[model samples]
Target: MKTLTYVSTKSVNDLTWPTTYDNTNIYSSALSVLTDFQTAGPRVIESNTRADELVQLMKKEHVRMKIVVDTHNHFVGVISLEDLSEDVFIKQVAEGYKRSELMVADLMRPKETLLALSYTSLKNSDIESLLYSQRENTLQHLLVIDEGTKTIRGLISSNDIVRQLRLDVDVAFSSFEHTYHSAILGQKFQSRSLKVA
Candidate 1:
């Protein structure tokens, strides 16, 4: 058997800690969910990423939404698979916008127009409150913003909520406007059934 002794260097400076954490134990709660960027990290794409490339990326990643960031990696907007569809591209071409020239920035919904919920607010809320807010806003995806940092903290999806609650939720909406409408209406029907029983 051989034994070795380890010694620490006398002058170790400028060492840095890892910024990443293991996310295995994260879960959903009445306070807030774990799917937020603070926990799961944001799925981001560059603003200059081509629309065609975006479609391929989404398919490869098995993701429907991606956060759009600038060259400096600052959050700019968000893009969805729905926004990168062949139909959308075809329509844009019909309107004289060159398909080859389109970029993620052009296809993303500007952050200002997106619906966001405060992380602090979510901390004090329950699943029912989340459902109510989703219904009221007709939102399939809700961005959680940290009030102190004023930065995106995470995302909450209607389907995720349904899965967590073990409810059968069909979120197949025809358009952006219909996304949450169906969920809200479904919740209403569930409420009515509970009342009748």
Candidate 2:
């Protein structure tokens, strides 16, 4: 009698990261893809937070954006790292405000100008339409408000959308893709002639 032994040709080291698209979710809804507030609430910093402290927090969190809040814990405005580093520092220095004296309230885009989309609108709309709207508005972030509660339900960002789609969706959104990256990651920071009040 003759016996044969089998040798395995594959090992764990031969494996590679998955490049396959998530074919199961070809059609997705806004609610399905959006970064819900419950999942990742906006990063918050006090209005009086020092510029240096803000930078340290951002580095620690690996985030480029934050929401400014007052001592009462009410939302006051929003600030991005680009605004802090590019616009604030230069403007403050030029105006003779010491760097150590700089605060987030001085650099934020105040809540009075907050722009948003209704939750109903987002629920009924598609990603392409949203991208076009964001591009037209030149916004990196758009709040979604629940009309019934009159409260912010979620936030959408170009970075989040791009990251979600990269997993599986293969449609060509050439112009939108460009707009998304540029709006979010691009350094187009500009200083206002006068400080925001």
Candidate 3:
């Protein structure tokens, strides 16, 4: 009996330090994407907005998360759809309370929350794990803040990740494959009339 010639190559995989993306670079500007809220971030509630209004904003943004702010725009608390599931809001609406009458303060989680800064370096694995640990399986949105003021400076979403990866993949497999090592993605942070970081 004769055996066909065969060849196999052995390979080893090694762990690498996660690549970081500065949230300051990836986050959407406070003045741009935050069309829903005129102030800065999705924080301020008109102090007159109803629960229905909040729900509508959440649905429209497709974020399902919100940060409540006082009239001074001071960060107050956070509101999440989970807080007002059918169990609570339904009962209140049935009792004839308008969404406007329900202040965001009344329905928001405590001020202590998982806040982050715009300049912070975001590691993909760490962020992903953080969200999972909070029981948030897939993070559609994450807020980037100003470390000095704890104020929101911008926002980030999963789509951004996909966009970046696609860009990188394209460059890696292109004609410049031999020079791909020099194609690093570096981010410079800036905002209107100021250095964001």
**Candidate closest to the true structure, highest lDDT:** 1
lDDT (Cα, tens digit) per residue for candidate 3, span 110-173: 5675554343443222433232332322333456555665556665443443344333433212
Predicted structure 1: lDDT: 0.71
The best-first sequence of candidates by TM-score reads 1, 2, 3
Model 1: weakest 10-residue lDDT segment is 20-29
Using all chains and alpha carbons, the TM-scores for the candidates as numbered come to: 0.73, 0.69, 0.43
Runs off by more than 4 Å, candidate 1: 1-34, 136-138, 171-197
TM-score head-to-head 1 vs 3, winner:
1
| Top-down lDDT ranking | 1, 2, 3
Residue pair clashes in candidate 2: none
Greater-lDDT candidate between 1 and 3? 1
Q: Looking at model 3, report the run of 10 residues with the lowest lDDT sum.
A: 176-185
Residue pairs clashing, model 1: 36-154, 37-154
lDDT of the structure predicted as candidate 3: 0.48
Alpha-carbon RMSD to native, per candidate: 9.0, 13.1, 19.9
Error of 3 at 177 (Å): 33
Q: Give per-candidate clash totals.
A: 2, 0, 3
